[model samples]
Target: MSAPNIPSSAQRGKPSAIPGSSPAPVPGPNRSGNTKTSAPHQEQSTAQSPQLISVQTPTGGGAIQGIGEKFAAQPATGTATLTIPISATEARPGGTPSLALGYSSGSGNAPFGIGWSLNIGSITRRVSKGRPQYQPRSEGTFARIERVTHQDGPGNVHWRVTSRDNALSAYGRNSSSRIHFASKGNKNIFSWLLCETYDVSGNAISFVYKSEDDQGIDLNAVNERNHAILRGSVGSYFSRALPPLDFDYIAAATGERIARSVVKEVDWESLENLPEGVTGPLYQWLDLHEEGLEAVFAVQGGSWFYKRNQSAAGTVSSLENSTLSRTVTLEPTKVVNRMPNVSDTEKPRFGQWDVFPPFELWPSGIDIGNPNVRFIDLTGDGRADILITEDQILTYHVSLGYSGYGAPRSVHKRTDEERGPRVLFSDVDESVYFTNLSGDGTSDLCRVRNGENCYWPNLGCGRFGVKVTMNGSPYFDRPEAFTQKRVLMTDINGSGATDIIYVRSEGVTLHFNNSGNGWAKVEHLPSYFLPPIDTLASITATNLMGNGTNCLVWSSSAASDTCSPLKYINFNNGIKPHLHVKITNNIGKETNLSYLPSTTFYLRDELEGKHS
Candidate 1:
């Protein structure tokens, strides 16, 4: 046979394999009979070194071809490239190999009898046969190869194998080749096989074959089931795996299972009852139901207590029969006011005082500036209670109850001590008296007839007069007394016991009973600057500064420019002795003055040396 020669064009550029033709097997005798051949022919084996299969066929006047090999002799270890070439004829001396069957002409056909070349690049080998391998490539190989197939005569097939792998692994042997060709093992099962088997909707997955039929399967239900399984199998794994779900969402998704579980685990009865119109989690119900529970409490207390109907207004007669009772009654009586009485010689003595009036006072009767007293249930019992004060006495009568005043009783004979039958008065001149001094709790009765004439007038001119204790009764020893004067009871030293502040015309004295005996004098200010003996002076102790023990005396004298109307005197331990006085004119204008201890006395021109 004549040796094949390369054409001039073939010499300029590499020629591709002929379409519908395979490379000629090495020309030698077949060695399949287990016999040794010549030295040059010994290298060829009948097994063909697992030769790669390639096929090509003509379709629509064009060729279809496939070019592949058994990867490398070994598994592809790393990245490799593959290249293939195709042509209608092989360029050589005399004649080139050509396909001349019923080939249709097309625009896609290559010139010079239709040559084609493909390049595959960067093939990486993954786990296969538990070994690292790679695909091979030829020089100037493209990044990818598109396969085309062709058919030959009598259903015959042919292929043109690529030289890319051979070129790229030129220095390597069969097993060590750096380049390889595509193979069945290179396909990823997960990406190609399993992934193709499923249809995707958002994040959910369904069988591709059954996707249409299972379109209505609730994904939420599947998620809940998955969550339950995962939460159970992995010890609360779903709690960590999934985003936290709201309680209501969980309950709705799980269809009462979550609620039942929570109910079974939680103490429902111990929790407060939920309010009306409230739903969902117990905590939400509790929060929403608080006002409803409070309303329930109010309703249970009484229908009349919080009722607003006119029938429920006025007099709630139903309440009287019920636990609720009226708290006050009124009666008509003659009013009187008696002055201090004279002694046997008809001289006005300090001891023999007259019986004050049993005034028919209104329930709201009191001076404008004085504290008011009203008939109220001090002990919370449903009964009428009596409260008496200097300006008013309230006598509650549930028996003859009315919204206004009740029935009156006949005038009964008064006790000798009372001088005649009369309404109880808080400012009785006698030893025993009752008043709501601090405006808290019930009215307290104070008696002052236990000590001796330790009430000497020279000790201090009693502006409101003094009452000597007649008997040594401990209950009456302290003589809880209140004049029209302002008295303050406080424990300045922080002891549990209380001390008394007695403000009189002469001075301000603090009587602290350190041992609960007679009043021991702790502080005695000879006098607080005032207009005169009686100028409607009002004294109050207030802690103006934030310090715990510093007390300031707020006092007001006669409301005139000549009379200092307001004063702030500091009575703390460390502050310099000074008095801040504010005077007001007849028209209610004011002036302020700061008086230190060094301030000299001011002589009044009208009073003649009596310091003002």
Candidate 2:
């Protein structure tokens, strides 16, 4: 009847909908059948073009006062938009008062209202935004208080301090303070200091030095002052007043008393406090402790006495200079107690090193560090056993795994006088090898000399059978070259049987063993150049690469300083072979790895020196 009261394009600020185009509005409720009609004659327009929906009351006086879009066309695909103009009256059907679209209370079809639509579970009140409220903090008796500004929030922050706790220890206390004893980690001394905890603010000033005659200084007042109260020279002659004693703080600060302790000097003839068998005059010093002061008297001759907490009686202890070195020629620089602070209650009565179970030295009187003692495996077990040669007897200690070793037992004896080897060769011309020459996975002894070679097959349990004389070989022809270090035994060709390697200035000769009795094969690898005899330290044959074939690692003597030029020669299964030779020059000593036992092999890893 009234053309649906649609506004003009100019008034709505948009172009009219196309005649046959689809309504591309955003997806929402399909309010097609929900449109309202006022009068019986107000039959809904049946046109398929886009049109506005208008509502009227039963009296037909005024229609719902607003403009709204009604979907009369088909929906299509495209970005769609709708301009919702706020209405002063009812804008859309089912919308609340002053609202364009109605909101449902819950999942069901409930009508819209002015109240909040979101069902916040059991919450009945609305959430409003405001600054958080905090309960005020109680202010205690503050020694020093100040207002600290807050970085955030509205008001100026008011901060208060009650008191600062005193330091429990003087570990980091200032050296200038009289009450602050000299502690270990005082950085002011410029000395190297180490500590678990340190504070640069100095010790929390305490009342130990505070005086009552003069106005008593509070903890805050003392903390505010960092300079020393009394400054002067140290020792017997001081430019200022003497340092305050326990009760002298008040007198010292006010100059009320120049009281001093009685000084006494005793002659050496009256030294009745000396420990038994100890000579004196012992040098005395006051040593400070955490709990109290201690009087210490020590001497360079190896005796010390201590009186703890000013006690009348003192304790005496030995400060003997001890060493762990095996040699007696060179004197040690200094003796340091590594565990100096270990309490007496934690130490054994005889000392930690006095007696160790399971690892006790055998034979009772023998020195374990004796050069004649050797650690090796006579048995097939992986653990190392002990071998001691004294007089002419060879004593063996079988390893019982980690539990320690079995009792010492005699394994063998030398028929050629206890001096060494035979009188003809001497010890220098004899080289002995402990290896699996018999191919039985057990080590056998082989003695090689300039004139003759002997093989003693291991019978088991550290016992050997009769010695078999080996055929004379040209490898040991020179008595000078037949020394113990000139010969090396190893598994050269991945065979379980051991092989012998004879090193000389000219080259190296490798001999393959034949059933632990004789040499089956021999190969000579010429040296690229002869190594300097004085600089040559040792030549080792070990399975460096973990491969079955062993490698020759020649090292220079420790007397050589400069880098030793190295040449590597790999002899792989007798194929294309290479040799490694190192020549050293005078400069710095190189660490010799020959000290490592022959029973063990050095593992060659990727981290090995490229030149080695």
Candidate 3:
């Protein structure tokens, strides 16, 4: 036969068959059954030998592609490498989750594709160069959104978010918009905003979206209660900035350093009229000034109150912690002289100083402006309350149940008195009187009294004014003289009608309400019915054992004693109740509101300034 034209290791002048001393010289026959190794293929023990790995199968060219180690002679060890990848959203195999190797023996000892129980759950490594990352085998890669935050406030809200990815060269941009009214956490779940306008801040590899929208619509109840409409506003005011989420997107474009810039007073406005169909809370402004005096008014819950400033001057602004020292005296500076739009419904029927919530007078030393103070329940809580007004500001004070007054508080603030529409009378001295003087079920208030007035000096606006009403309609024509001092009221006789106690030029006169329109100054009682009272505190009607009928209990600074003390007296029949006539049975001793202090142990607070 002619010489076969087939290519072989010998024909190509290359060592094949696993290339290591010719496979340790496998036995071969010399054209016979017996075999012998070729001389040139014998293994040699030399220090110059090269390290070689004998793969089970010999490969042609690419069977073992990129490894470039030339073998001169067989040595001891070998080295080879295999690789795989994992992508985002992709996970490794469940059962073995491990990487390993495998082997096989076949043609001339080449590696069997890197044996691996390695099931190598396919990982999507970046298919292109430059921007490489591990992703889900399904789509190869994905983008990231980070540094998201939503700040909620009473007025408006703000949001911040960023879209990013490992591949700076990715073709698409990231985006999302959402509105947040409350707090929410981030997990697999995320939220979005509405009515939002976005302003892009950074690049796509890490594009940031900062958005804002008004939440006034959410605080409808607050606005209405405050008597103002919180319409959509142009800007927002934040107390502080929301902290960043991703620690990477810093200046390095990582998540960490992405900070939210701080913003300040975008000054908000409350429109008086709300758009139609939009229902809001009950917003109403009430005039709380006393009958003829300049007063400050404020609404607390369901009641109206006034702030008692030192000078009884004009109001200025509202306060944060009304309980604090509310005595911000206007220093006599031209405080805004705004007054009450005193609707017939808002004037003070200034109840009896005792029946009203009372506050301690600015005592001898503490001067908080107007040392002259009076008591009346502006909020109708049955306590002797005080309404203090100054600089157009109003405050409310209720008894603290501890024989003292609570911290006068003003919830809201108003700066300029000029902004409001009413005018206050700085000089009128006629005190107010609220009572059911007539047998009628409805009560009336004679806040301002004037019937052809002349006497009472105009200490303030000095305007001689008159006309009083209760619950709106005019009740009666009270003479200016009747209001010179507070008018006391009670059912004097067994008659269930409300009567009036007037102190006139003549001693004290008792005007008995006929329960209708006429007033009869009854002189039928004992020769001396009225007593000499110094400074009366409170007056309560109760049944005293003396008269065997309902009577009145009262406390006052004793004529001979500076220490205010309590006393009791009854009227005619035990049939009905009226205020007590204290001067009758008392000549000396009575327990006071405060406990007497002992010089033996600790000194009493009342014992500080004066002795009675």
Candidate 4:
């Protein structure tokens, strides 16, 4: 679908499909669609509208309007969608759920369902595992926009639904003024517009309310609240099947639904106007049914930071220029801390040291002076120490607790090699290793002994070696058959023994620790067997999913169909690379990304963002 044009009377008149909605007979073509967005009211103050479509007030003149005060001007600039989070059962690292559906086993327990339009009768017939097996349902309309409510009956909004045989049914009444649409899919999520009925005097008698379809879970359960999304409009009435729920309904062009099922509400707001150009939904909240929490993540620009249990009215206040989403993020981290930049020594104190700004472990000059830099607590002081290994000498900036970094000290030195040393452990029992480009550089002296050096710089010299050490004591300096390949030292199996993994454009090579002895052998994991992870902006392998082995994450600018801008190389049993999935959050072009060990992968989205 093209970007949605700003919502206006003109746009409202055109038919729009309500995704993730109940399968109802939509009443027409593009121009005659049943769903409608209210047109912009004649020139009026954006803060407040000139005319108040007020429900009966005690004084009868006017009382400030509330429900839609935030989303009054949603003449949708473009159609938007919502993604409700399903099962995070796949959240890596120990089966911990990133987002989980409700789970309570009983006589009838099903926390997974989809927005569907099924033959109500058929669902009552067949049984699966002793339970009725229902077909996939859809919240899509089958009614035409052209055949609209030509007339308003005594108490219902009526439309004609023609069958496949051209047999037109009479008076499609919207009895429950609002046909409550529910999604039993994995979560108790449902939505409906403010379709209300006013008495002759304009008093709202009832609204379109949603409820649980089968299990009959309490719609009013604590921590359970609905977000009244500004889903355009539905003409002046709702439409559905006339009497019997039989045939399918097809209407306007539709869209795929979002799957973030959790959300948090708040009071303060970001004054920045809503952004345009994006094609789909920017979810305001997600309701994690299993965590028993309503949450919203903080987005400075593109990267998202987590925040929990935010307060929200779940209503939008529309304006002429943009919709005043009654949603704001509360940054619990330094991202929004208003404190001035103070020296590390002068920074104000916080409950936990982790609450401070993300500490810049690598100082300013490192990037310009060295290419290979790693942060680890070499002294095991619980503070991350910086290690720079660009040249023959390694420099260390030991952590000074909360005070600052200690002076840089020349710790270990090694022979020439294209790559720097990689640390396997940070304790007194440290194991550091690096590739030796030459066996003592003696081959360069023997220069092109066979012209093979012209094709392969380090060929036949057999000088290719992986030098290892325990606390700087040499372990292995043998010839490496697979030299020049990217080497990464990580504890792949989580067995406390550091291992080596070799990476090449074609595939990857694994060298596990043989009984804790270094680099004993190798296993090649070919590329054809894995998803294509094209030219990468960055790549980090860690137990992000916490499934035991390592999960590789990379940023792909090419963003092929299989690879999203933010791609995850998810592992199956923590041994070999398995499947690949994209993070749905819109983290635009990335600047930097790193794995914070164990499971967290930190991403630096658009560095220009003012947050912290």
Candidate 5:
């Protein structure tokens, strides 16, 4: 067994020993051959022999296994060891070698038999899961390599390309270039990015190419980041471009129909029809409803109806029908007052008839056609009169004359002094009276003075001095001097003269004046009896029950004997002593009344009197 002569081909560029080869002898310097030649040249006959190593082909084919005897015969020198350096281009498409073999051989001459076998095995190339390589079909063409980056801060690399020209142009103009088509491929554990970028407007434009197939899993991740960047940039661009987009305009443009169910759910019963040509905002419609427009148009038309604006030329009749729905009517030639026509020479008719003013003409009073004003005499001669009261100052027009009525005109307008014409009788203290006291007139001027002492037990005393006029001359007379404590004057004596009845706390005192002069106190029996005096306590002198004599009836507090138990005292006697009568409530009703002597003697009565 000899060591094979293997070449050191692995060290550098050299060949190893052949597979079947024997070691060859080393040639050395022939010093012994030269001595032998100098000694007489004994015929040096080196036997010329053939080299042992040789190659021979197989004679017949058999069951071929392993290397299949392909290397059975070959010259050993020719089968030297070999080492081939594989270039990147020689590698497989997926960056893997298709076949690799390393071998060595020994040098041999006389057919040195060196045999070896090789088992041909399949090789699988492992591809990475990343961006694939972008192959350019044509030369001088470029592929765009787009990469997107997402940073933590506000800035984001929206769309970046590998080409310096594209990036520079895009940055210089601050604009985005269009993206052509892009495709993706999946590797074992990554993805491949194959993209093409070209100019859409130019004919001679070239496409840029990129190959990222060999890239690892990071390529897929980069692709995902790029996708997110693209989405965000697109969204931001759209948002910026469409600013101030009103939803109402969009809805209207889209012509969205309101839901019928929503309309039905609203409270239509409360809605009122609106006038034409009026529109409202959504909030106004929701809050005010259609009636708001109707009211506005009504006010604009100056009536409770709808009408055209001033631009339309229409007649008064058309305007009336369109602007008004109802009209008001009034009466004329109405009775104001009535009285016995008395001569001017006959003492001016002591208690003359009163004339009432028309209600419409009276200031600060009830309106005309008011039920309360129906009692007013529309054609009264004293309509021009004016009443001055604390509550209000009223002016009346009767026969178009102005006279003082109701509360008396204060003598000194600026005087704070209490000396003035005041009403002698009134239900409430400090209240001014507004009624007709002179029988031959309309509503007259009157008022009741409130005295501080009037409410006190013994100190409550006041006087009303009336300045009467005779023949256009004023005469001073104290009608309330003797009949001071709450008195009323009327023709109670039937002597054609006025009398006064003073309502005192103990009883009522009757003062009769035969000559129409001041009264003199007259006391009647059973004067201690008085009626329940509430707010309705007043005296009325009238021909009640159709009697020919005037009667005096006074109402006072039941506990205060100032009055006679709400009874009538008749003075029909053509003599000195008048008749004393007692009246009773026929029933609990205010309208029913009876005489105490007998119920049959009671008669329905209409009491007419005057107040000042």
Candidate 6:
């Protein structure tokens, strides 16, 4: 036997006689050209030192496998030997899993006609046990968490969370603050966040955790980091993927608050049927439904009709409509609130003549009718009962839901300092109204007079609490400057509470109810939504568009008393955002118009339904 023809370390990059190389040359005394041969080693010598090694793929590299191997390179001069020792060993620090190692040998064209190689270790991942499965949850009163089904690969998924209502109360250190969207992949692991929620003021209020398929568990730092995140003390460490929300707008859009001053218009001349002898000064009122606002007009002769704005078959009919699906008798002489005196210039003009039409006409179960005779839901039965202010006495009639109203009982007796007794046909005093300022679904009393606003909460069972006077603001400091006619005590944001809608020559300003006597102005409708009104007697507010938003319904005293229900429309008409006021004419054709802030939009030749 002789040494094999192999290259030295100096020829490393060039192809040489390696164990796996092709067409290997055998080493012998009678073979090959410049190859040198040496006699077999007289005595074998061994040298050993500890070395760390790892096997990796083409992607990136990994840490040491913590296993060991031994090899001896054969030389062309003397016979060489190779050896591999297999043993069980612990996985390396920061390594993936435990591995088993082994080796194999074979005879080939080597100097001693033999060769050897080590087999790559096979990995056995330790399966995690007793891990809690993912479960969806909603915490606090407004924070919610749901699992995300969309996954990146086969391993794990993500969870999503959203905070609404008042964001400040969504999460904190309490149990209500912990809304789990997913359990950890390993029961011992802490939480991992994917996103976060912020309030209008840009403060983090909630976290969206990720735990579906993740296997990595950080036992030391993750828990503290997660606690810091929930506390909102982490600063802006994590990227804020979700933007802050305009709570007022979101409340209205999500029906969390009342849609304020959202008025819609309807022209009486557009309807199909009209009873004979039906003339001007017809009593009009608004009917609210989930779809939008419906305007009903009652002729003095017990004949009435309604107009609805349906994108498809919107029409004027005395028969079944959107809000009034059932036909009922119209008691003309029973209409209690008298139209306001048009000759009185200083008296509030809008909603003065608007009576809280019978609950049969307005299904919202709200007493947004006559300020004097209120039909409100003092109880949460979803039915309106009677609350009337007459002869200095306040009375109540509770609704039995499926049944009718209970008997009338006296709730309060007004003092002599209060306004005078209002008879049925007397002018409607715009300064006083019955609304749910407390948002308890019961009717409360509101009086705006001499630059001050007073509210009396409904204490259930027809009882009244002590009177409260709202603090003055720049918007409401001087009642004389804007007048009671400019103020509307209605729920504009769908907050279930009454908000202040102040109509000025400039635009409609909103004072959102703080759940107390105070008001906060979040946003307002621009000035373009001026309905044609000489007095509060001509304008009324209700849900006319069937979108659950309150809209203004009114008619011009100079235009044959023809009703124009002004639908509250917010749109970007060319230059900037303005209210998109849609008017339905007598022929049932819609005339689209744009209203901007600080501008009073009126009907013009270009704004006619025929032209549309």
Candidate with best TM-score? 6
Which runs in model 6 stand beyond 4 Å of their true positions?
A: 1-281, 288-292, 311-373, 388-394, 400-430, 473-486, 503-510, 521-537, 557-612
**What Cα-based lDDT does every candidate model obtain?**
0.26, 0.37, 0.29, 0.31, 0.26, 0.39
Candidate 4 lDDT by residue in tens digits, 393-499 = 55668776556567787744324332223232222332234222122111111111110111111111111212222121111212333332244655453333445
Clash total of candidate 2: 7
TM-score of 3: 0.22
Superposition TM-score, candidate 2 onto the true structure = 0.32
Ten contiguous residues minimizing lDDT sum, candidate 2? 247-256
TM-score of each: 0.21, 0.32, 0.22, 0.28, 0.22, 0.37
Cα error, residue 608 of model 6, in Å, equals 29
Distance from true location, Cα of 12 in model 5, Å: 99
Task: List model 5 lDDT by residue over 16-113, tens digit each.
Answer: 33323344334444766642211111222366343233334334333222211111112433332322222222321222222222232332111111
Measured on C-alpha atoms, candidate 2 has an lDDT of 0.37
Overall local distance difference test of candidate 3: 0.29
Ranking by lDDT: 6, 2, 4, 3, 5, 1
Considering lDDT, which of the candidate structures 4 and 6 is the better prediction for this target? Answer: 6
Q: Write the per-residue lDDT of candidate 2 for residues 43-106, one digit (tens) a residue.
A: 2346754555443223433332324422111134211122222233232222212223322111
Supply candidate 6's per-residue lDDT for 142. 61
What TM-score, to 2 decimals, does candidate 1 have?
Answer: 0.21
lDDT of 3 by residue, 1-612 (tens): 121232323234444433244445456776777777643453555544555544343333322111111112112222112222211222222211122322211111111221111222111213122123334245323433223233542223223322242222211112222322221232111232221212232212122224323211111110001223368668877764322111111011011111111111100121111111011222221122221222223343455333321211212233221121112121111122333331112213332122233334322332334523335444333444554444444454654433455656542223422222122223365444434543422233333343211111111111111221222222222454354443456555534445554444333344455443345533322214333433343333432221212234333334442321333343442222222111111212121111110210111121242333
RMSD of each: 46.5, 41.7, 36.4, 29.1, 56.2, 27.0
* Angstrom error at residue 229, model 6: 24
